[model samples]
Target: MSGAATSPASAPALVLASTSPRRRELLARIGLVPARLAAPDIDETPLKGERPRDYVARLAEGKARAVSRASDEVVLAGDTTVAAGRRILEKPVDEADLRDMLALLSGRRHRVWSGICVIGRDDRVRVRIVDTIVAFKVLSAEEIDAYVACGEGMGKAGGYAIQGRAETFVRFLSGSHSNVVGLPLFETRALLTSVGVPLG
Candidate 1:
């Protein structure tokens, strides 16, 4: 019975440890569909004075380990955040918060940090942090007001979506575009491949 249930060459199932639609879409771009989507329930509160890099890295690994996985399953998790210097700008709590975030980012360079973690079939963990620099053109009061009214930036990190209307505001960008979106495809693909996950 045991012999019939096991195959030597069968690839382990991929489990995505997030429920974000954008993450699902990003994974599909690489032709990999997760066999299961497990949204890990972990406290994401930043430690007092935690830097953006440390904050994302800890969350990614925590999420990956929080999910239950079988021996034949590989878990993948990622966390992304926007930071202005040492300030970590998380999801906007309200319209007022969104407006403030946009105003703060009006005409300066900020960083988007994405931390990716993969736990392989052997339970070996791999993590990588990717950073992207983005600059926004100076936004006028009218522009900020209109953007706030549109409500596109609500609930998004840094109060803006680079793939949406916010793209127009970008004056400069350096590094992985996908990192700013949510996951860094290059780093993610490499980690997945290293952990024996098949990729198209």
Candidate 2:
């Protein structure tokens, strides 16, 4: 597509159904300017025995539907989870879990799952799930202590942030780098195009 400006009448209208700064910046990276930003309120509790892929996908769709009350706009929502084997690692709420998470992720491969929901103007919803594999280098006790001391691990999945200090700990990443950062550009851009969103 050309770098031409779409007419306001022809421009795609989307309501981003999330409040994550990382997700917002990612949309800006691909030149999508959402007509609205709606932070959805939904229970994030994982169902008993629910796997990471199913968990993220359900939440993504729920968030989109929960926040899409206003009519005439397309709604987009996403949910991401970090998994170490079958155990899904969520944002740590306590220091003990945080410590365990960091240690377990060290020198091991983990998967990050991101689920995306695109609700079209016609109320037709299309979804996609992206998985990224990452391996963390062996970390020293002192390094983990310093990282946890700074309180940066509190809200991040897998007890680390690839865009921050934890970048040094990543030895290999085998999938969509953007998905691990909270959004998947390739799948996201494709969804937007299907719903008539202009992209360059």
After superposition, candidate 1 runs with Cα above 4 Å error: 1-8
Please state the error at residue 158 of candidate 2 in Å: 1.8
lDDT of 2 by residue, 88-186 (tens): 999998878888999999999999999999988778878899999999999899989988998878898877788888888899999899999999999
lDDT of each: 0.94, 0.88
| Model 2 accuracy (lDDT, Cα) | 0.88
Which residue pairs does candidate 2 place in steric collision? none
Clash counts for all predictions: 0, 0
Report clash pairs, candidate 1.
Answer: none
Q: Model 2: what TM-score?
A: 0.92
TM-score of candidate 1 versus the correct structure, residues matched by position:
0.95
- State every prediction's TM-score relative to the real structure: 0.95, 0.92
